[model samples]
Target: MTDTAPSESTAPQHDALLADLTTIRVGGPAHTLLRPATEQELIVTMRDVWQRGDEWLLIGGGSNMVISDEGFDGTVIHIATRGIQLVSQTDTTLSLRVQAGESWDGLVAKLVSRGWAGLEALSGIPGSVGAAPIQNIGAYGQEVASVLDGIDFLDYDNSEFVHLTTAELELGYRNSVIKEGRAGVVLAVYFTLTASPESTVQYQQLATALGVNIGDGVPVQQVRDTVLALRASKAMVLDPNEPDSASCGSFFTNPIVPEHIARALPADAPRWVVDDEPVADVVVPLGETPAPPPPPKPRLVKLSAAWLIENSGVNKGFRLPGSRAAVSTKHSLAIVNRTGADAAEIAELARYIGACVLSRYGIHLQPEPVAVGVELA
Candidate 1:
């Protein structure tokens, strides 16, 4: 597609505060803001910004982003396109192609209502479908990677639209190629879901809430309701009435460390094995039989960030003496804008919590949200 500038009649919003768009409500004004309401408009607007060589930013649901108080100095394109099409279906399974701008939780709700199981455990996640693959968003022991089939991507380098398979996306623990500096935009996401009425309860907390044991099966709707309840209790779900929900859900991701590093932490620290080295298959001559592979090495352990923060002497609801930013009273992982706090204050709280965790555990905590014109240092 050819790149062209938007007409004067279609000029973007000028001096729009990013705080109005983002969930955290802490950023300054954007020099220019464009809300593309369709796939074609989104592509055209992005191409125009690129061709003009103007600095640009893309926002979806704006749930997982933190912008500086000084604000963005360039164009901010908000993805507002929405649609959900059934790509294919069988008696037992179905593939869905969802627009990038579709609300993630909304989609889960619809899927559960239809008795399509797969993403019930991810209910109450606040963000757009496009942001899901970028963050590999997950909760209650189920990740986007588990059901993702592929994505229709717009490559920034060539301005070409291409399809990327799940393997090509390289989704990992809250990470993917798009998050790893790959310059591209996800236009749509593909997911394969089952037409099952029940889903397996894998997370301990979720199971306990549902009065079931881990590995037990429960109705998909029940799982969604229970997961939503769990998220609301932690203040992870976005609710206008809940002041604590004004912050980004889980500001810090659980850190995955090598087995030895995890061993150094206190025995009481919550951790789970996330990955392990795979044993390579032995090769032998055509006439000879291959011997068995060696045992796998110690696996990588994922440590709980909330536990690390609390144990580091930074308790829930803790805040700087003069700052309006504070740790969420309901969950230590989140830093909330207690009252009209600026981006700097929020960043300060995050840095302090990270430093405290590093000092106590010797493992640095990584911020989960995308920081724009803001430094955690």
Candidate 2:
């Protein structure tokens, strides 16, 4: 593919693409914006956006992203590319390939309805399937990486297709090469799903809520439903009317500390083994674990970011003594738009909540949104 400059329009239509595209109703416009309906068009348009020396921001469902109020300076390519093909299937397994533009939740919904078990625990995360591996999106004790078999990407530096393995993705807590660096746009993803109804109920809260136990198999659809319900309760699922769900999912990855530090917390601090390997020895909860009771190690145990924020005195629907935005009334971790809000306002509010958490817990909270053009710092 080659670059081609878009027809000139000075009205900033390029940037307006995000006005309604993302969950946060904030952000400026891209100097140029294009939505490629197909891979070919996406590539061609992207080539032009790139070769023109124009800076670019690639957006998908815009759910998990937070753009700056100032907006993107270069071109913005909103990938609407689509396709979800079950290229092959077997009695106890399936080989599915999904284009980057496919809605992540929509696909999971379909798979669940079909009795597919692999992704049931990750049902409600907002964003496109392509963006899933970008941050190794996870929830309800499951992450996308567990089912990811291969990834197809457009390597930005080389401008070519690259297939990567799970190892190459370097999956970590809400982090991957794509989320951390300028990895090229994902084209499609290939997943090898199991045929048997194998699943891990690693999250204790979810199991208890579902009245199931860890390692006990449940219908994939049930898992999906339960997960989505749990997420909605936490304001993690996207809902137009729910202000808390308007922001990114979890605002921070659970902090994993050394065992000694984790053990230093009070007897009630939550602790769990991260791995079964004898060498594996780190466990701390961000405090989202349900039904486990308040972990004894509020200080030594990694407190739930939500718990810390609330306990630090920032209650739901909290606003600065004088501010427009507020914390979600339903979820403490989310900085929300109680009314019409702007990016700058959100950033300021986030900083306030973060400062309060730091002051009280001495733990720095990191945002989960892929902040762009905006400085949360």
Best by TM-score: 1
Per-residue CA lDDT of model 2 for 1-377, tens digit only, reads: 44444433212354464657787667777767777778766766666566676777888998767787778877788887899888799898898989999999899888877777788888888889888888888776788888898788888887776788889888987888888786588889999787655466778888997898887877676677788888888787888767576676666566555567555555655565454343334566687554544444333234467766777788988887667777888777777765777888888888887888678756678887778877674
- The collision pairs in model 1 are none
* Candidates' C-alpha lDDT: 0.91, 0.75
- For model 1, residues 122-222, the per-residue Cα lDDT tens digits are 99999899999999999897999999999999899998989999999999989999999999789999999999999999999998899999999999999
In terms of lDDT, the best-performing candidate is 1
Q: Assess every candidate by TM-score.
A: 0.94, 0.87
Of candidate 2, the 10-residue stretch with the lowest lDDT total is 3-12
Worst 10 residues of 1 by lDDT: 1-10
